[model samples]
Target: MDEWLKAGLDYVPRWIDYQVQHFAQPGCAIAVAHQGEVVLEAAFGTADLSTGEALTPRHRFRVASHSKTFTAAGILKLKERGLLRLDDGVGNFVPGLHPDIASVTVQQLLSHSGGLVRDGADAGQFTNHRPFLSTAELKADLVLAPPYGAAERFKYSNHGYGLLGLIIEAVTGEPYTTWIMREIVRAAGLTETAADIGLMTGGTLARGHSTRLPLGRRLVIPGDNLTNDVASATGFVSTAGDLVRFFSQLSPMSEAGLLSPLSRRDMTRGHWPDSESVLDRSYGLGIISGTLKGWDWFGHSGSFPGTLSRTAVFPAQGLAISVLTNAIDGPAQLWVDGIAQILKAFHAGGAPHEEVADWVGRWWMLWGAVDLVPIGGKVFASPTALTPPLAEMSEIQVTGRDAGKVIRASGFFSPGEAVARLRDGRGEVSEIRLGGTRLVSQSAFADELVARYQGFSKDRA
Candidate 1:
């Protein structure tokens, strides 16, 4: 691995752990893969808050709508075998569909342009109010005329993928889960993934949790419900490690993968713009794609009842990342983006040199914490609250072992100022001074605040 990448990975877990603690999230698991090999797999917080079970990289998450990517790959795999075609009409193999839906092509459903209902009238199945739709229930929803004609616009429909599952069954003469697991899951060299909850045999599945609001406390949600027929759409259970491994193979640059380079290209192409979304995202076959920081990323996000997860593959960087959280309001999206930002910063700054290697720690002030990160040959005073922590950071040029000068910073910050470290009688650095501001370790700062304002509570009362 490049030294810059190593530096970024070294700090990723620390940042993620701080975020989890600061936000009081249930738990999160993250995995990163480069050049088709996993380089980092870490987890923070707890699997079950009630039991205080520690979360680990081995824990599986619902992964939810990420199943769509797997299903899309399965469909393309069938095409490779000459078993079916993407342009085939749905009714060609699976009978008993509404006239309008029957005429929709397979490609339409894969790209979510079939204009089918997102979920049937009652989406309670997603909120745990009812079980996921069975084949009969899903087919009944398709029996009704679609709200829009085929290819009118982009419309996401879980029922559409459910119908694709049925089509897979019809063409292969096997159950959706059985065929996908044997052919796709196992074939992709993923031992830590399952098509549905019922098939999960190894590893602990992290229990989901509700938000700590409206009730003032989080409630444990048993996220083991099986998706009977809609398993292809939202029933995958996987670890972050397995997710990154699978998504890495989806890159067209990958030499070893389940699909041909042609299929991978078509699947990741930006087919339809998500006009209704603010994120400038697109959909292709079954893949969700977007661009960030001038880098094109293609992957899928998933939302189960009390879990939210996201994964992205950057082909140009030969890197894939997966972030899975076990809370309804987890910052998986933000953290994934933040991780990317950190990686980009390190790549831009290069590796830390020995001159400033030890000048690394998170220092606190009255407003917030600042991470004194050593990168390249200098140090950056980066705010902890920002998603991209290193953005607009203050650059420090070390002049001595315990002294530096702020050479670059915002106009409001103390640029062209001398930075110094204060040490105690033991000759250990205990505090830092950035011009007029005093910074200290978190524990020291807390103690100082308590000592200085201990009587304020009583006076206010």
Candidate 2:
């Protein structure tokens, strides 16, 4: 394991333990992939409090709206095959719903701007059914409203994606579940991911749970009395391993391969700024697009009766992280944010290439009594023993076993040879050597090197 990652893994359990005590959660699971490698996979606590079954990587959990990305991918596949255009109206597929709804297009549904009311009124009808929903049957509950804001502005609609499910059925002449399974799920090699709420398939699927009822939320699953009728809109179950693979196929900006590169790019192109009221996160084809923790991240969150889940993909770094917890509220959200922070610290150094650091802020680090302040492109440190603060013109010498550079008024150092190597983006220090101990640390020499150079830059802002 990378030393920093090892340390992070150690910290994860500590955090998870705190969560279980505070939230009364049964258990939590986390998976992280970096450079296409599974760096961290762990389960904390029990899967079932009553039986004392421990959680495992193979446990399945209902990912709630995380299913939207899959449904969106199926729609994109239909578009890829030239069967439909995203701009095509809903009236083009299901002829049964309000014919006036023709104005709402596939693109609008994927972007959640179609202004279709949620399936709130007759949702109980589907909940009582065992078979996969037919296109017309699914549309029986939807109601249409005027476009929310000139079309393509963010207004999240589960009903809008339900319409896309209808379109998928129309284009393939197959059930929505069948089409998604054969086309996107199978092709993506996600043998463990599926929408088969009726059949209870997907061998590694985690059992969905809920805090609302001690018996857990009842849903329609195949071969078992358990299944939730919310399939098309929010009824898919997956393991973190499968979700990691699912995200691996897409770019940071949007879905690709499932749709034409042009369409994929277009879908990811933010149609609405995140600042708009009621829509703080913009939509992209089958993905959510936003900047988080100084990285361009895209993905969605999911929630169900007993499960809350989230997955984030940092495309620029070719990394993806996901967390699933089978309690109403658990440590999953914190785990997601912590993973992002760990990645930020890991890749803190090196000159910017494809990514800009305009959003990365200064971070604090301490090695024994040496206090490091990362600001304006430099890591500045001062000794308490110094008679007075080093004057602005004072030449601060760099010291260490290795020959490193010195900041005129700041005691930051960059190994003279390592700096040139990092400048070329070839050499990256993966561990920190501190106090004669090679202890694993998040802030290594690279971060300090980057800040040191920035401190000497002509502009300090």
Highest TM-score scorer: 1
Off by over 4 Å in 1: 458-461
**Candidate 2 lowest-lDDT run of ten:** 415-424
Candidate 2 residues lying further than 4 Å off, grouped into runs, are: 1-14, 122-137, 143-153, 202-230, 252-260, 274-280, 349-461
Candidate 1: tens digits of C-alpha lDDT, residues 122-205: 899999999999999999888999999999999999999999999999999999999999999999999999999999988999
lDDT values, one for every candidate: 0.93, 0.59
What are the RMSD figures for all models against the true structure?
Answer: 1.2, 12.9
Instruction: Return the TM-score for candidate 1, rounded to 2 decimals.
Output: 0.98
Tens-digit lDDT track for model 2 on 340-440?
A: 76455435532222222121212223432232222223333332122121112112122432222343532333322221001115543333232222322
Task: Give the distance in Å from residue 385's predicted Cα in candidate 2 to where it truly belongs.
Answer: 34
